[model samples]
Target: MTADHTPGRVTGADGPAPVPAHGPVRAVGVLVPARDERDHVEACLDAALTALARLPPEIVTALCLVVDRSGDGTGAVARRAVAAHGHTRTTVDVIANAAPLRIGEVRNLGARTLLRRLHPVAPERTWLLSTDADSTVGPDWAVRHLHLADAGVDAVAGGIELDGPGRLGADPDPSGCARPPVPDLYAANLGVRAAPFGEVGGFPAVVSGEEHALLDLLRRAGHRLVTGADIVVRTSARTQGRAAGGLADLLRERAAERPVTAVEVPAADGG
Candidate 1:
């Protein structure tokens, strides 16, 4: 079902009692933005819900699926996926943005919605985990973020593994050549502390590179940002994507190369 801005507790057929805003550790809000993602949305939600189910009993979680100008059945498919997974404690919110929104705008919409539902002090304890509709995370995704948060980390830039047939023969360095380091701040596997994220005005309204922009904002503010190779996510390798200059564009460029091995340069700021 679609979500509204109601003030009362949210409940579903198989959902547990409403979780209070106050708790030992703050809650987690997983935000996903999609457009015409009917082919991948269900699988993405399934993987996310599975990972979230592993959180501690005291840590509440919410899944916010923002369907932006989707002419297909993406929203309905996502709702059904949530129902099938049946996590009794995780609340699900489906937002329908009738007008087309940039990827950054859609992410901001979901984050703002979660922010409004959170307690004033919750930001310090809360975490915002973001991923894409074309990606599937590991089972320990939420647990990894929780661990980082407990360690006083302000943000996390996770790694990604490209998958699908499109990636089969698209090796950029076929000659086994070495290439310069590439940045790995993709939104498909990013986590942020609620406080710093909100303080930096969330994500910009740009259609691409918003993840890197947000990371730069957090770094400029002196937030503790870390990169976790263990928290890698599997994302689609298709050349066509929802937004221009996105992962699809990168994949297309890589496919045209002669295949090379590129090393990841650790962030100068340590994260």
Candidate 2:
């Protein structure tokens, strides 16, 4: 929403304000796509900022909140957080998603915009993490990412553990994770290599299947997708409420079609 003019960095003719270029930056850009998410936006930003605090300010250069046009004050909340956080070195960008596109479209738009200003190799050494505005990162989320990167893994598919007593939609399922016909691989906790994410073109503008689609591309390219105890993020069932028809029935409706086109993405190399 603001033009970047931070010292040591050139402001884009039309991009969010740039972070103060105290030194060179590298790492994944956390891209959050939201729509009218004021309900949990503040907590989300706080958690994200907290996670970043674990590392040096120079590493996590920015937080890109892609806010779709909403009558609800989601955008306003994002702006407030940016101001409150003292965006000294951490650049906060508010992108509008007023266009009538689907989930994949939003991520693609954001990833492309952010990638232009980000360090290409950082994602491999860094993570381009994505989460909805209704989600929050774990206490050690960022730290874990750095750890995984140090271990030389390219893609980390971490899952979110819902906050206890989440919205009506997040009831615990005794049925178990495997019982669900279509398991969700949400980007909320997905940490992927930046170069691979870009090489695969990030997310596509589709009604669904964004994460799986991107994963498919990455796997085919022979990147390693590792699961880790680290890199966890807490997500609200409210954002994925559509599956169950309302906030109250979300978890129960886990069985559904894959959001991304499900093709055989070859197994990633363990290397």
Candidate 3:
């Protein structure tokens, strides 16, 4: 079997090269975690692959999907999507986690697997991006993240706009027009350098709020973080999600006011 589909941790000679002190980002590894998300995995992979293609051909880019205890054949569906795209510029791989795991653990697993696959490329110069199976990113998402990294941004927190059909909470205004959402850090839209991510021990193995936890850790460790307002990701509005207290739960918190509409979130101040 190829190393990409191989199980277990990558290390020693088979692992990536030593850390580089400073340089342009030569590689980007994207991680997507799914649990019983057969319906959403295809669109997720499509969006991720398309975004990866937007980057210059010289930059090594890859997408790794971590399917955790999914009985719905999410892994198989993702593989088919990758094959259908047949994208030459980016390598796509899927890992099946038979054991039950939290979203944070799944994300970490996908991150490590992708990072190792990008061997001989120093982790310090690799950008690790995170998204979800129920979300879709625009073609410019990867490019925007790379531009920020190139500008010395160690990590990026992106905004999200609700898509499809569901609303988040009750309209506080009750003026018939929905109030704009207060932007918060979401795993569906996040990016970080592999070095700092590893230094902070990666993401915490929690059910939800892993993204916020990781960013907070990075901040405490003195890393440069910025909000990529242009890197907005469109996430699901199902009102039911993989993790507790996640975006879906937020949306389901209140009864649907009207048909789901795109939520406009205010850009948060940069850290």
Q: Using TM-score as the measure, which candidate wins?
A: 3
For candidate 1, the TM-score is 0.81
Candidates sorted by lDDT, best first: 3, 1, 2
Q: What tens-digit string does per-residue lDDT give for candidate 1 at 209-267? A: 99988988887887766654346788887888888878788767766663444422223
**C-alpha local distance difference test of each model:** 0.75, 0.60, 0.78
- Find the candidate with the highest lDDT and give its number: 3
Residue 152 displacement (Å), model 2: 1.6
* Candidate 2 TM-score to native: 0.72
- TM-score quality measure for candidate 3: 0.83
Tens-place lDDT digits, model 3, residues 73-134: 89899999899988878877798898767778889999989888887688778999999999
Residue lDDT tens for model 2, 1-271: 1111111111112333223232222565678888878888888888887777777655755578888667788899888987787646555678887878777787777776666656444544446777778788876776676555444455666556665433211223566543422233566777666766777777765566677777777767776555423345666643455222322244433323222222121122121
> How many pairs collide in each candidate, listed in order?
7, 8, 0
RMSD of each: 10.6, 11.9, 9.3
Candidate 3 residue pairs that clash: none
By TM-score, the candidates rank as: 3, 1, 2
Show the colliding residue pairs in model 2: 4-17, 4-18, 104-204, 105-205, 122-126, 208-259, 209-259, 209-260
- The positional error of residue 263 in candidate 2, measured at the CA in angstroms, is 32
